[model samples]
Target: MARRKRRKTRVVITGISGRLGQLLTRRLHRLEDHEIIGIDRRFFRRRPKDVEHLRIDIRRKACEDLFRTKKIDVIYHLGLMHDPRRGSQEHHTWNILGTQRVFDYARRHGVPKVVLLSSTDVYGPQDDNPAFISEDAPLLGAQRFSQIRDLISVDMMAQSYFWKAPEIETVVLRPVHILGGVDNAMSNYLRLQRPPVIFGFDPMMQVIHEEDMVSAIHAAATPGLRGIYNVTGPDALPLRRLVGLAGKKPLEMPHVLAPTIARQAWMMRLLDAPAAELEYLRFAVTVDGSRAKQLLRLNPQYSAADSARAALRLGAWDAPSDAANQAEDSKGATAA
Candidate 1:
């Protein structure tokens, strides 16, 4: 009898309902002869018919058992809490313990590769540094308790997994300010009022388009790749200029006074103004992507201005119909 060829393996992704995970699932499903499994707590609005959806919390031990039983080939870990109020205990339970359980299952099931998604906020606040900071730069410990716990979870998982299972290829992607058609914490502020609130004169912001972020993760899992890479877009823009580009005027607000203003806004029920979230607005963090560019061969298609224009044109601020139509025409002209 002739020898039979082995079947092509399947790839599993956690946090499938997230913006990045949804994009990735869609992209991978377009490829021929590859199986994609998505695991998320909530059911996604529009998942491909062929893609298998598993509604499960990764923090639970049973999820690990399910993975071990299925014997998935590659796993992408993209689940984590960003809310500052969640505190260290919650962060450890969800991010660290959850990751460890998944990692253990992958090891037992002989999973080939794992890609862990981390945040560029791990670099901490850069007050006035103009140049981009690379992956080689030391990780500034998270200032807030929530961030500290999240970063620690990622670090411990990455380091321990690498040490224990040298054979399993593990890669970490730290993305900065992921934007594009998503109601993320950062972009929510952009949607607030006409001429978004700006903190100080020089709050430099760098953003990574959601598409490019997914591409980087895809590249990481494509056989023979390991190590950490910082993923960001081409340029960093000042908050004021970014707001202006979004077709909104910029209202300069002093960082010191923002707390008081935010408190009042919260009292008035104008904005969800938690103190921790307010602190995040007051600082700036930027990341360099030279290594990602060179290694992943990724050239992010969207610039900061492009993203701002797109978000504005998408009517994120709920502009009047006439104003939105005019902005759309202007965006078209600029693109041309």
Candidate 2:
């Protein structure tokens, strides 16, 4: 009789309801040799047909129950609240404590690897530094809503897990200004009428396409790699240029005036919009991805302009009923 073949290893991902999680799940589902499992509190609208999805809050103790049944080989922890949400405290519970729960589960279950999605926001404001800030650069003082919490969580996870479980490799991917066809806060800002609001001189903006983000996660899971790595697009451009690429113009505003203006415009009520958004406007935040490219062999295909256009064409932002007329008037006023 022929020998029995071993079943392929299964990989689980958190935050299946989120934009990045949805896209990553669809991509990973297409791989024939792996089984994909997605976990989230809410249901996904467009779940891949081949993937298995479990609805459970990672913050709850019940999350450990699922691990007993599935032999998970890898865990991709990508769940977290972006800015503008009123859930910073909840985000910490879910992002930090939830991560700890998953890490504990993986270690106990003998999972070989885990990838934690982090942000370049940890590298705080870059005022005088060079354009491409490498991973070696220090994580400076915080200015944004997500920066402080992300830094604290990543640092704690790195220290606690890396030394304890050497066999269960843990990797962190720090990405900056993630842009793609996903509906997000930054993409919403791009959809506003031209003469788009600018807090000060348009600072240099660096972005990463969502597909490249998935690629970096895949690279992290590949054996023999463990540590933190910065993932970003190859180029950095002025924020105004990026706005123009989305067919919008920049409207200069003083940093001191943004809070009042944003509040008056009633834009602060939007998801992830708050006074914290204005802090990033005063300085440039860039990242050096040479290490990701050299080590992970990741080649990002999309440019900042490409990401801008894709975001617009995909209708990632909601437009008001009179948006066309307002856009036309803004264009006429600018041309005149």
Candidate 3:
């Protein structure tokens, strides 16, 4: 008996050097019939097997040359840079001008589909925000934080392309805090014993496992599903209780002084989260995952609590009491 050959789908993934991008590329490659073309501004240290990695900034002329020659079936725009030192000229140049060039080229080059990775941070964490936010929620990302605010415009651009181009299918995934993976910045911060938190405003928090986030992107990349979807785990929990569930003690810090302290922390590389990120921890910004469930049929295997536990299970974590676990378990159940 001879092995039958499967038709390979030509998939192009940007930001292939990052953890999330690499995860998506690796998983997508597991399918026997998908060829991966990876593009990144920086070099990827560990190149995955069968992936055609290109170290060309999307804004550069070399990138344009590749776009001219390659026939891209679907372009995964996961190239947005999220760092403590974000909002620099380089960040803005790449995220704004860089992505615009890619989008324009994709459109002109007859790419039939696109998968964009946006963030829940686009919706600012307002004190009066609804407990569950849907895709229709207004994008009120913090104007004071250039890093986060820049994402809002990028997200808007992707959405506009989705509506404007009926010829191409575009699916945008707006996921909440992406945690529980070894390489995630947020997860590493939480893995430390006694992670910092706002003193008087421990608002509710929600997280999606790295696996779930990738799954949502996978679902969106499926042909014919073209729309914006809020992707998250099943449950949302109070920030204080979530810390408890993660088996980590919270380092209480006054909001007024947190910026100064967080700046030092960021400098030390102990906490990758900038002071601007504290607003999100202080105010709840939960997203409604109904659209993902209905359209993408994405059933997240990890709940909010599950994600925290996995992320904070590092050596520094303290074991919770049985009674405490029971209480947190109930809270998680109600959240679900």
Candidate 1 lDDT, 180-245, residue by residue in tens: 666565665666675435455456778866656777888888788888888877588877777776
Give TM-scores for every candidate, taking all chains together and pairing residue i with residue i. Answer: 0.82, 0.85, 0.87
Q: Can you write out model 3's per-residue Cα lDDT over 1-336, one digit (the tens) per residue? A: 398776588888899878778777766876667888888977776576778988887777777666689788888898887765654776777788867876787888888888888888888888888989999988988654657766787888888887677778988889888876545555876787787888888887878877678778888878888888888776788888877878888999898999999889788977777778777768889888888888998777666667787686432222335424644665686679
2 or 3, greater by lDDT: 3
Candidate 3 similarity to native, TM-score: 0.87
* CA shift of 250, model 2, Å: 1.7
lDDT of each: 0.71, 0.72, 0.78
User: Model 2 RMSD to the real structure?
Assistant: 7.8
Q: Counting only residues 3 or more apart in sequence or on different chains, how many pairs clash (N, Cα, C under 3 Å) in candidate 2?
A: 3
Of candidates 3 and 1, the better by lDDT: 3
> Which candidate number has the best lDDT?
3
Candidate achieving higher lDDT, 1 or 2: 2
